[model samples]
Target chain A: MFEIFSYSFMPRAFLVGNLVAVALGMVLGVYPVYLAIIVSVLAAIGVEKLRVDYKDYAELSLAVILSSALGLMTVLVSLSRSNSSIFSYLFGSISLVTPEDLWVIFPISIFIVGGVLVFYYGFFYLSFNEEEAHMAGIPVKLLNNFFMVMVAITISFSMRIVGGLLVASMLILLVATALRIAKSFRDTIIYSIILGIFSVNSGLFISFYVDLASGGTIILSNIIIFILVVLYQFLRDKIRTKRFHYLTSFRR
Target chain B: MNPAIEICNLSFGYQKNLLLQEVNLTINKGDFVAFIGPNGSGKSTLLKLILNTLKPKKGEIKLLGVPNFRFTDWTKVRYISQKVREFNDSFPATVKELIASNMYHQMGFLKLVTPKLSKRIDQSLEMVGLSKCRNEQIGNLSGGQQQRVFIARTLVKEPEIILLDEPLVGIDQKTQHEIQQILIKLNQKLGTTIVMISHNLESIKGQSNKIFLFKDMDVFNYTAKEFTVHLSKKGEWVVNNSYV
Candidate 1:
């Protein structure tokens, strides 16, 4: 596991050069970050407006907004002069991360975590019932807009690590798996963070050894963990109900 | 001494279709009032207007003597919308956490749940007769139990007035009566004024002190005795003229 770092100076230089080249080539500047924030915020607002009229058709609203966003992206990409290396953003690589990306991600990670900590209960109430949250004086509009901005920024920045295509799974799958076992909100947060850290590190390790796409490997790891957790829960419930024993006896 | 809610010449409507117009109504402190009307009669809209969730196109609504738009003391007033039926049952939350969320306003931001706050949550759950289910997942509860959880959430704040939009719509008769008893207890014992928009007017027939019938873009107010007489007259007419 540790032999790669100890072997040769050539390997170290090649690694550093690749990191710099990929970072500059893939993410370039902060323009995409700003663009992501603006576009996602607009999409969120549009979806909300549509939801008011078609309250029962929430998925329809999401689909409409998503297709519109995809269409806009296609038009912009088509207008661009060059189309090479765009696949890197569509499927990310761990080695592509630069010191600059770390510098941006570090502060943002802190801010997002701190925001969640400070507004934990407020968010809990809002998720439970927006109208009731407003009645409880939670400043629903301000917090909602703020949360949307944070989410946009997170998705944009994370595209460097997990790619835009798989970033949603990174955000959702860990939490979905954690929810299966977590009894409380705090526990769910803790379990999700732990699972996220475990998946990313192990995924990078395995990808390095096996020569696989880092982003896809990470997402695959998350899916595997989710399946394992579901299986464990199914077995636990079966055993608790004495059905597993009965089934075994019948088979015998 | 001031009325719990005061609406004067209030009107709400779209550009072409007016839902409510020139709606003048007053609900006194500690009054148990019910808004009863058929579908599309704007009962829910009236409640929304009072709660400042919607703006009146014409006149004014005052809550606890202050103008509705400027009213910031939200802990004093709680409005439970009909949309409570749309609650996400799969949400990962315990009954305690649900009730504790109501303390967010008073406790301010970035605050931890204190021992006192926990006790208040327990008391609220107890009032709703769900103290034993404090640790249970909210989604695992029955529909009536979940409704009680929403009520416990409202009661945790100890509001001066409670507004509910059809609290008993999907509940069983037993649970409905239990909820009614809770409302009556709150009004009579704690003096918490209640304004509930209910389709089941008979359930609130004897309980509410004032019943407002929403019809034809207007609100017709009636005392309990007067409403009973009016309801009897309508009932007699239907009975006397029935072809069946």
Candidate 2:
């Protein structure tokens, strides 16, 4: 791991991933998930409200567009060096993660995270009940748009480290999975953070040992934990039912 | 005096089937008016039209002394729709998170207003009398409790006019009465003008001061006694020609 960090790229990946996650966790936590929920739910009144549109399709288009753009941009600036070195930007070869990548990643992450933290509650409210949110004078449209754009930024930037093939797994594997075992949104968030940290560290080392990819290993770990949680809940329920029967029989 | 809410020649329909027609009404502010109609007779649609969620093919509505559908007037009006039936309970949000969100949206995102924001959250929670359960997740809450959360959400915003579409449908009698009394008090004490639609018209009498019946986008007004004559009075949800 120390040798991995010496390569400059690993540290850059860490900085980008952590910063982007924090920003997304704060902003999307409020906007698209909450406020958009209200709009999307009511939009259910009209068909195709939640239906994925050309814009969503456009994100898929980004991978191809971005790969070419990276290839072109890399050549334009390589002035001194040129070769398969471009593979660093194209695929996250840990060895290729440069200090330059950190410069690109840091400011974007902070801006996204800082913006979300400042307006946390506003985003929180628009999400609660949009009709009421609007009546209460909440700027529903702005916050709704803010969330979509923020999520867009997070997905776009983070796609570099985790790759598009695996980026969605980050949220679904950790946050969405932990939610099954938790009650409140706040609690679910806490649980996801705890679960995320544990899953990532363990997965990282195991992947190193198994000679597998780090990101995919973390996602697999999360899936296993998710199964365990469900099993625990099911067993606990079963035991409670048995206890209830025993008490009823004694009373009879 | 012009009523707080007035509709002239109100009518609404989908592509072809007309929901209501030839409707006219005048309402006073602070009046606890109950809207009674057969299922699909356009009760919810009429209320939605009042809130501008649905547009009438013909007719004009005035609310809170402003044209009902005008862009700005909506801020003064609040609505508690028939249970939204759309919240993904699995969606992460605490009861407090859900309730406080109403006021937060009002302040607008991208601006910071602290303490005052929390105070507003508390006040909204207090309004619906759910201040204690503020920290609970909305998904974990009971249906009746969730309804109270919605009430708190509406209360927090402090709108001048409120429209509820069938608030007392499937909840227990106690929850129904609690909701009814709360709305009645809001109208009488705060002078908030109220228009409510109900599948259970009978339960609303003690709380209602006026009544409107929906028939094919048309509206007819009456006192409680007359409201019953035209309606089933039994308050059953599927109102099919049960008028007594």
Candidate 3:
């Protein structure tokens, strides 16, 4: 684990790490996030054409693509005969990131962030109600495909920093934490991004000094933040209820 | 004076089974029309066809004097499906924020909500009596209040024609009455055209100026007064006298 962070002294490593965290944080939800990524990867790899050609059972598209991805990964792993590379792909190794990775991540980040900002309202509406968004002339299919493409691009690149196994958690957990305290959608997104940056940076710093896996450290940091937020919400609600009872009792 | 919505020999089917056939109807401007029929009568299907969500297998639909396919001015129409309740409640958005989302298309891409748009949101909320709950999370609202919030969301768009599919289904009586009153105001005061689908004919009898009854694959049109007489003759007088 420590060997993986030996390159932590390089500022580019932290920059790439934090960028991955932010991209993951921006797409916050469990099922939708996974669906977007899966659909996007499938579309990118021509699986969607199969669905279109064989319209008889289009619902099986997701299952077909998911299994195909898993099978391909297994085959690739066996053919490469390099367990160390597989380990880095599964759990992430910051030391493994090259300047080439930075170049790839930079342009992808700009595209994802720019697209999200431009269609923020459409995305928000679609999330709430698909039918209503469609009726409002929001081009539901186009927006959905665009979202899936963004998720695919983000996941494909960010997996280098967060690992394929933990990328979804990084996307969801901080937003869940933000939802516990943030009252509005904008606030929730802003808080989640801030929390994501903090967790990634801090986890990187900790893993560098403490010799822990960077991806695992980052996930642990996010979980700790989530637990603290949940506890705080619970205690705050309890105190408010107790105060309400006391005030009413005194009045009576 | 062009009709608000015109359907000519419209027919739609799923697979090989026809759901609606040879449906021809004209809804005049500012007409409060209620589509009353049994389940599977294609009332909702007709609304979807008018909204261009569902394509008719044959015939044509003209919306506000333009062919349905050529009707690019969607801002003039607002549709509230019965599935509005299916919205993700856990989504972190205030009632005000959700309502403001209706302005996105009109505001175009990448534009911030201006003060004028915010004022419109306030007015829409005020109309639906959800002004006090503007900052409240939508999930925290009651089912009826949530429906009202959706209605406010539609109202914020300021559409010329509002179509609702069972807007009062599963709502409390008080909230139902409140929603009806808001619709009545929109129709009577603002002269906005309203097309609603409801199973309970009595509730809409007094509010709607015209009624379209669906039976088999045909539709029968009638004025509100004529529908009352027709229902009485058919020995099916289930008028909700409380509201009447």
Candidate 4:
């Protein structure tokens, strides 16, 4: 495994890896999924209207006209990359996890985690119901924008690892999966964060040993977990309903 | 005295459709005003526009002394909205967690309140007579109980103004009477101003001193005595026996 770092680019790859991981984690950690969905939908619409030759807005300015170009770019990039490569990057692993990755991930994660708690009071107002939040005299817009920026930072950083295709999967899928088993929004968030940490660490190790794509493996693990949760729920509901029917018939 | 809510030349529309037109209204402090009209008379829209959830095309809304959503102190206001389906009660939290949202002031930094939060929570729930269900998960409560829980959430904030949108809608007469008593008690005891948007004039008649008849995209005010005259003249009013 030490030989994995013999190459100069490996360190840079690691640096980028750590940076992306932490960035994604920090964003998913703080941002509200509802607002992020609205923004992402709007961004897609913006991408839809731009002309193909529009030079300045390729990455961010997404109009419908430019969407084709974006889609083509996505496919071309994916096809060129090796099937076994964990990250969707076509260039393959560059420098392995360097000190730079650790540096970026640690401070950024700390900042994101700390910031969420720091602004917890403001967010509590905004989270439950906006009307009550505003009525409570919380600055809803500022807090909303602040949360969005956190998500943007996360998406920008993690795009390298999960690639554009799957970053959303990581953020939304884990929360969604957790939501299935949990009873409340707060519980879902907590469960997703716990699942996120476990999935990330485990997936990374699996990628190292089995040569599986780390990002893909990470999302796959979440999918597997979600499936198991659904199965459990189905069985429990079935048993509960059967018992209820039996009890009613016996009483009759 | 500044009205609890004031809208001037307020007009709002969504894309090519006009919802409210040149709407003007004033709600004074301690006033229990009911906004009544047909469905889609822009009643909810007006409430939302005032809340700044929806912006208007050609008017200004003021809450307290400042224009819409500009109030610095929310301790002066509370909103008991029509029970919408959005509050996903499936999330893991007891009534304590749901009410915890209201105690933002007590634990101002982390938004986490333990003994202090529970004390406030218990008090608010007690106001609605659900103090025993303080630890119960919100989903386990009935619709009326949930509505009361939300009202408790708002009341805990101690807002001077309360904006309720059809608080009595979809509930039994008993629940409606119970909620009405609560609203009346808050207004009379706490001197809180309330603006309720509703279709049932009779449900609000005893509670409301003034009724703003929203019709034909315009809002017209009627004093308590004028209410029967205005409803009779409109010929569109139907009295539901639930309020009777």
- lDDT of every model, 2 decimals: 0.74, 0.62, 0.74, 0.65
TM-score of the A chain in model 3: 0.77
Stretches of candidate 1 exceeding 4 Å from the true structure: A1-87, A237-252, B7-25, B37-42, B53-61, B67-70, B109-112, B199-206, B211-244
lDDT of 3 by residue, A1-252 (tens): 011111222112222232333333333322222343454454433433554455565445444655555554455445544345556656877886777667766777888888888888887777776666766777766776576556566765656677767776787677779978888888988998899999999999999999999999999999999999889889999999999999999886
Better of 2 and 4 by lDDT: 4
Tens digits of lDDT, candidate 3, B123-165: 9888888889999998889989999998899887788999999
Q: Candidate 1, B157: how far from true, in Å? A: 2.6
Give the DockQ-based CAPRI class for model 1.
acceptable
In Å, residue A212's CA in model 2 sits off its true spot by 4.4
lDDT digits (tens) for residues A9-112 of candidate 1:
21212222222233333344444444554555555455556644565665565566566555545655555546554567668766667787788788889999
lDDT of 1 by residue, B15-119 (tens): 668999888999999999988777888988888888787888899999999999999888789877787758666777888888888888656557457788899
Model 4 RMSD, rounded to 1 decimal: 9.9
Candidate ranking under TM-score, highest first, comes to 3, 1, 2, 4
Pick by DockQ: 1 or 2, better one: 2
Question: What DockQ class does candidate 2 belong to?
Answer: acceptable
Question: In model 4, which regions exceed 4 Å deviation?
Answer: A1-95, A121-141, A152-165, A205-211, B1-31, B35-74, B79-99, B102-107, B114-118, B132-142, B209-244
lDDT of 2 by residue, A23-58 (tens): 333334432122322332232212112212333443
lDDT of residue B132 for candidate 2:
89
Residue A157's lDDT within candidate 4 is 48
